[model samples]
Structure formats: structure tokens, C-alpha cells
Target: MKKICLIASLITVFALSSASVNAQYYFFDGDYYENPVLYEAGVSVNAMNSLTDLGGKKGIGEKFLKDLNLGYTSISGGIFFSVSYKNAVALRLEGTFGKVSSDDKILAGINDAAKNRFNRNLNFRSNISEVAALVEIHPMYIFVDWPAKETTPPRTSPYLLAGVGYFSFNPQTKIGNRTIDLQPLSTEGQGFAEYPNRPIYKLNQLNIPMGAGVKYELSPLVNLRAEVVYRKLFTDYLDDLSTTYIDPALFDKYLTPQKAANAKILYDRQIVKVAGINGKRGTEKNNDAYFTANLKISVIIGRERIRR
Candidate 1:
């Protein structure tokens, strides 16, 4: 009986020691799954472009890459702050700045079906700035970046995001040495007696932004990310080409002599005008859209448990 008691005591001590070692190992190496919520801050630079009725290749093609018009790409950046929930979900607020531009004159050989656009010869560039609150969901929420561990999650994981934002845009055109704002010109006879149906488009509008991305855990505190986000804009005048042309007489009747002269030149730069009251200045089939390809880096800021 004494011998049996000794054997049992020895087994108990060994098991206790093993459990203690494992507990210490996980604590020091970040191998455990339950983590305190973390706060992170990030910054991103964007390559921005748009697909309007203007300069892209005529055929409807790739949404992001194939439709990319390099000439119209603009460099942009944004700052973001996020609260991450143990590698599962992150709520972030980000603000971005970029520019988008296109010119119908950039592409040649307008088909018979597209001749109206060829003769239209419209172009515009707009400065785009937006602020959004987005939620990022990680399908594979497990992150295994630490060394010396048997784990299932990979170093990188894909995520999806959707959100709403408010944006401001002002479309401009270059006529010789001067830059002109297209909105005030009322080229489509907006707010005029002849075309009351066409109202002045507001410069600021709402947008639905959605996209997918992948993030790579580069270190305990840093992550490398790439994402493509597209915005569905409420306004179609981002390119300043959204409606049919109006008669030159309307501008003269509505504006001062000098202003009317500028409108005539800026409204349409076409070499030859298609005779009609409402020429195809732009396609009304769809609203304008823009997208950004982002390269970002995020640094874990506060501790796992943020103190209120």
C-alpha cells in the first residue's frame, strides 16, 4: 500500500510539471487563440482610375485590370484607424484622396455605332476625396505568423469589405492655357427653360464602396495588405460627360457674352458637331464608377485590451 501511494504521487507531480511548461510556452510565444481585442492604425497609397462613358476601350471587359486606362491613373493616399476583434472582424474609418480623368479623343477609329462619341470629343479630370466607415471580415480568422509552432492558419488571409461613403468631386477641362469647371457652364442647358428636366448635378454625392483584399502578417505588430475597392457613385458627372449637347444659342441667352463664348468652346471641343438638339454627349445607360488599388501597411497600436 505504501509503494502504491508513492507511485501515484510521482505520476501526479509529472503531470503537473508538464501542464505548467505548456502554459508558460504559450504565454511567451503568442500561440494561444484567445487574444485581447487590439487597436491598429494604418495608412495606404492608392492607384486610382475610373470607367465612364469616355476613354476606356469600347467593349465591356475586365472590371479592374482590363478596364484600367493608365493615362488617367492618379496617385492617392489615405489614413485609417481600426479596432480588430481577435483576428475575426475589424471596423475601420478611412479617408482617401485621388484624381480621375479620361478623354474620348485618346482612342481613335470610332465604329459607325459609336461615331457620335467620336465626334463628341469630351474630356475631364476630377479630384476625388472620400471618407468611409468599413467593416472587414476575415474568412480565415486564424493567423499563424509566430515562429516555433504547429498551426493551421497561413501567413496571409483574404478579407471582404463593404461600406458607404461621402465624396466630393469637381470635373475640370483644359482649354489652351486655362482650366475650366464644367458644372457652372450648364452645357446641357441645366436649369434653363429649354431643358428643365436636366438639373445641376451636385459636386458632393454618396457612394457605396465594396471590395476584397489580402493581408500578410509581416511581424507581430505589422501587416502588409493589398486591396481593390470600387465605388458606386450617385452622380454620373464625374467625367463631366453625362448628357446630350444643347444649342449654342442657349448659352448666349443664359450668360454674359464673354461667358457664352467660353461655354461654346468648353462645352464641346469636337472638330465637327453632330447637328441635333440633344446629341449624344454621354451615355445615360449607367452611372459613373471609380476604383482604387491600394497598397497598405498597418501597425498594431494599443495593447490587446484597449483601456477606455
Candidate 2:
């Protein structure tokens, strides 16, 4: 009986040892793991547009492609710097340069909203540039391989980002053979002692950027990204239209004789209105916002992740 017991114990030990050697264990354990710095630098091309009181139909604003027709889309480009950890979190420094514009004239024959907008006939173009610092979170770990490899992560990921930035803009418009800078003119009664309520607006302001995106590894060292981001602004004058029309004469008081005439013509292009009355030109209830669709390519370089 003693010999039989000894044989049984030996068989059990061998079986357990074989299983331990053959079994698969791919997940990380509580053991010390070292995550090293990973860096990526990239350039992007984006298409951008703005939503303001100047353009779009009078109703709940539609988003994405639905509102594309309302905005005059423009092209932009920028560079990005990134530092990532375990492929889960990233800090990005972004510098973007772009232009945005809106024209009420585009509304012609589109809807009744056009009539009011056409009569208002306000249009503007602004060159904008900004630098932002953002944090990104990627929640789901998607895999390109059945078992993740050491020093490698999933080939694709989706992430969300939010951050604040400072931006500068100069609004301008083409007045036939001439180009007019709109901010100095204060077309909507801004900076007038008579309309003391309207304060002069600054060219530099803050913006909050929020957005989501997906990334794919085109190769071991190269990645591709497509993202859509919207920047919320506190100022309504991005397009230089945010308040009531001032007496056209105010232009003469504030600008040169030649500039005064040009400002008056650009201020109120109303094809139709009560001849004697200057109406509320725009609403200040809501601030302006802009969105961008970006395509980016990046190269990944860094120390490999290690676990022991």
C-alpha cells in the first residue's frame, strides 16, 4: 500500500508539471513592468468651417455632413507632437493654421431663411492660427494579432480628446477691387460711445477643442489617423457679425472718408428692408464655433515595453 501511494503521488506531480509547461499565459501579472516613453510626430491636412449667426437655416442646427452645405469649407494644415504610455494615454501638442468664412449670399433659393439672411447680407473671412495642449484617452484595446507581442501594441485604436487653446484671427472681406479688414470698422456698433454696451473685441481669444478619432497602423513604423474636432468659442464676432446695425453715419465718424463709404456698403448689403429703419443685424444669444476634419500620418519611435 505504501509503494502504491508513492507511485500515485509521482504520477500527479508529472501531470501538473506538463500542464504548466504547455498552458498559454499571455496576460500581464502583478510583477514589476516597465513602460518606456513612446513618441510620434505627424502632419495633418484638415478641412474647416464655422457656424455663426451669419449663415445656415433658421432652426435647430444640423451637425456633420448636413450642415456642410451651409458652411463654405476651406483647407488647412498643421503639425503635432505626441508622447504616449502603454498605448493607452497620450499628451499632444498641436499647432494648427486655417481659414474660415461664411456668406449669407449662398442661401439664395435654398430656403426662406435665405430671405432674412440675404437681406442681412453679412459675410466675412478670417485667418486663424492656434496652439493647444491636449490629453487623449483610448479605452478599448483592439488587437491586430491573436496574441499581443512583447514590445508591441494593437495596430488600431479609437480615442477622445479635450483641451483649451489660444487663437488669433483677422477678419477680412473682398470689396470688389479692394479688400476690407472688418474688425476696425466695428460694423455692428461695436466701440461706439452711443452704443456704450458694445465693447471693442480683441483679435486673440480662448477656444475649447473637443473631438474623437480612430487610428490604424499602416506599417510597423507608420500610422494613419482620421479625426473630426470642433472648437467652441466665447466670442460671437469671428465672422464680424454679432449685433444690431449702427446708423450708417457712424462709419463716417470712425473711419477715413474713403473707408467710411466702403464700410457702409459692406455693413448693410440688404437687397430689401424698410427704407428708413436699420434693424437688428445679428443675435448675440449664442457664440460662434468651428469644426475640422483631419487626415494625419505619423511615424512611431520609442523604447520597447518590458515586463519581467
- Across residues 120-142, which tens digit of lDDT does each residue of candidate 1 receive? 67888889988876778987764
Candidate 2 stretches greater than 4 Å from native: 1-35, 58-71, 141-152, 275-278, 303-308
Model 1 segments more than 4 A misplaced: 1-34, 58-68, 109-116, 142-153, 303-308
Q: After superposition, how far is residue 168 of candidate 2 from its true place, in Å?
A: 1.4
- Which candidate comes out best when scored by TM-score? 1
CA lDDT, every model vs. true structure: 0.74, 0.73
Task: Give the per-residue lDDT digits (tens) of candidate 2, residues 1-308.
Answer: 34334533544454344334422333322332223345678999999888877667644344434544534889999898777655666777788999998887777775554567766677888998987767778776423332355533556789999887778898888888788898887787688788888898999887899999998978645779999888989898898887777788888887888878877888878877643335677778878888789999998764333444
What is the TM-score of each predicted model, taking all chains together?
Answer: 0.80, 0.79
